[model samples]
Target: MTVDDSLSRGIGPVAMTVLPQAAADDDERAAAHWSGQLATFGLLEAAERHFRPAAEEGDLTAVKCLVWLARQDGREREAHSWLERAAGAGDAWAMYELGVSLPRPEGLEEAQRWFRRAAEAGHALAMNDLAALLARAGRREEAKDWYLRAAEAGVTTAMNNLAIQHVLGGDRAEAGRWFERAARAGHVDAMANLGRLRLEAGEEREAASWLGAAARAGHQGAAGLLAELPGAAEAAGEAGLP
Candidate 1:
């Protein structure tokens, strides 16, 4: 199968079969699959062994695997090289990874460029991250637009961030709506934020409920806030709050 076809199918049953034959044949496609399996099992060295050969043979999937393996080994420069190679090949995830790996301050502009490319390529998380970069640069309107896109794409963090943007814009009602959506989607920060809003509005019961949920999910700030709420000690105990 072609590289693009293998990429589209991912590492499935077909890719997983006949490992011995694959190794004997030196099949780069099968090597990529084997590398993925090894990586999934936390066998980083073995994965790298397979990945290097396949990557050298021009397997973009293998190149991506090398990026992850390099990161795991704390080889940041090597990881960046692999990420750049895959991103240049039009891999959306690679572009996003490259953007995040770039050093802040000095690499901010380059990161933004990569994030925009990834987002334009339909990477939902990239949209959220790109929005955050814009927001940090004081581009509120543009940030809100990207955040809305990512939120609509079902990114829980984006939903939470979009809610924060609304809150900053003094739209409490809209903020609450988005916060609730993110909280219901299991975003811990959103639950805590929603709880705080409820507490400020004198809805102590609802605040406790949301804070308790966030606390149960291991949010220390939520646990602390929940502990301060009247009649919340028992709930905090039930949630094993720290």
Candidate 2:
């Protein structure tokens, strides 16, 4: 497949490469740190091996990692104990994870509480997630506020989501600006949205540029629109551009 075809929708689920940053002052913490490093290298089995010892010693981070691994293994119930332990220890990420682990409706109120706690602790992901929950609860204004905060905190997905909200509210100019910001940050959906917005504004050349970039960056929506872009067929036919 061509690079564009392979990435027609997304880059796919690449393993996270960022190791957790922490002061590894104890044996368990050190092991947790090492586990994170191993996971960063996609050595998940090895990372889990280290986490066993740390979790046995009651290291919350290690426990949390086990929860994630269990969830990935489709044993969602297995995550609860570790997640609850870590959350009880005041781990913000753990709290957020625990909230999401529960099924909604029955768990919605409790999840919101945990999400609020995590967001108050400055978790940008929690802020964005809580915003989603709030919006689902018919609190659009509150959700928009959190989206604004998360976007300002450099969450590109939040920027894109906020842009969509603006689009819904008929503030296309602001939506365009936010979409541009998110598109520049490598959000393919935002790139596609921006390309469509540009096309709607009668900027066919710029739309083509954005759409082409979006297609190459893994947005199928942009790829589908490529042939419809003004002068696109002419340019592609003349230059053999895919």
Candidate 3:
């Protein structure tokens, strides 16, 4: 399969080659690979062997991998230890992941702190997530700021969510603008929502374009909505997309 196809959907067998199964007397490298495999395959106990040694040895990458797997297994305390090591090693992604896995109190203060650190280190998704936390806590102005930053950083999901926030806040104009921005960036939900909005406003031609965009981008709900439109099937066939 092409690179785009591999990334466009769920993980496949070959793409999950980060981990391998361990033998009775696996070497360190084999053990590490096996551990990765165990995590990938959801064999939590079997994966521990791959992570434990390198984590104990202060290997940042291993600590990150183990921490992520531990979080998936709900072993938060162990994940915390590994995350601390990786965070201390200056891994910004580790800080972001650690923030997400930790428990929250009083509106994600701890998570915000770490997300801020990661954002400063140029982690776009962390910036978006941080914006969401801020928005949930009623820090709309600050949230908007972070959303703008993340959107500029090419995070299309952030752009779409930010547009939703604008819409929720009764700024349909701003929402439409941002929705268009995200749609151009290939955000499927943005395309669908924007299309729906236009349709509601009787902008049939524009709605058809956006709905087609959404369907081509694999938004199933948008595809269904498109099917409900007059002559939509013909439009979809003529588009020659998806």
Candidate 4:
């Protein structure tokens, strides 16, 4: 990946400059709530002034917010500490986000701990990410179990990944079933991949539809294959099929 993309992935999206919608509709408290954010955004002095009080008062939301800021500011140590505190306090989302943020080896172990905690608490993405990590570490059976957990929790990425695993394991039928689930959930890569696999199995009509769906979703390879279908070859000036 490009440096900019890599950095963007590591840091997450830009910080929101406003309060959440729930906090906004409270007419009386909205002003006070936003005043703190205004301070944070440089409209007032003491940027963290609003966040500090909430954090000190042990507000989980405030702790999460502070951790987000630390992540944005590249303060890994502070973020790590805050995440540990929140995760220990039974914040599944915090545990999952921390799992996603830490480094490998040490980070991976830490990530697994938080992910396992969050997964047990019913965090879908944590289960999915943890399954991916387990698969990468060559624990395929355990990974499949985690993938099933994430799939049960409605994680489409886990569905797609599990389909690939099935395909690699020579269980094409099962793989197709998972691909169908992922495609129905609008996973573009899964649609494209399933389209190709279907075509290889001589299910051209279904493959074309899937390829068309994937192409419409901006998968360039799918678009290319869709362009090569039947009459499309003639449109591209190729000779008739043998």
Candidate that would win on TM-score = 1
Q: lDDT tens string, model 1, 70-162?
A: 665678899899878888988887888788878878999999999999999998999999999999999999999999999999999999999
Candidate 2, 170-229: lDDT as tens digits: 999999999999988888898889888988899776677778777877788888887777
The TM-score between candidate 3 and the true structure equals 0.65
User: What lDDT score is found at residue 71 in candidate 3?
Assistant: 59
The runs of at least 3 residues in candidate 1 whose Cα sits more than 4 Å from the true structure, single-residue gaps closed, are 1-58, 69-74, 233-242
Model 2 stretches astray by more than 4 angstroms: 1-59, 62-78, 104-106, 233-242
Q: Give the lowest summed-lDDT range of ten residues in model 4.
A: 233-242
lDDT of 4 at 39: 38
Q: For model 3, how many clashes?
A: 1
TM-score of each: 0.74, 0.69, 0.65, 0.73
Q: Write the per-residue lDDT of candidate 3 for residues 133-218, one digit (tens) a residue.
A: 88988899889888988988889998998898888888888988898898887788998989887788887767888888888778
For model 4, what is the error of residue 199's alpha carbon versus the real structure, in angstroms, after optimal superposition? 1.0
Model 4 whole-model lDDT (C-alpha atoms) = 0.71
Backbone clash count, each prediction separately: 0, 0, 1, 1
How far out, in Å, is residue 194 in model 3? 1.9
Residue 118 displacement (Å), model 2: 1.1
lDDT score, candidate 3, position 100: 83
Please give the CA lDDT of all the candidate structures.
0.79, 0.72, 0.73, 0.71
In angstroms, the error of model 2 at 226 is: 2.6
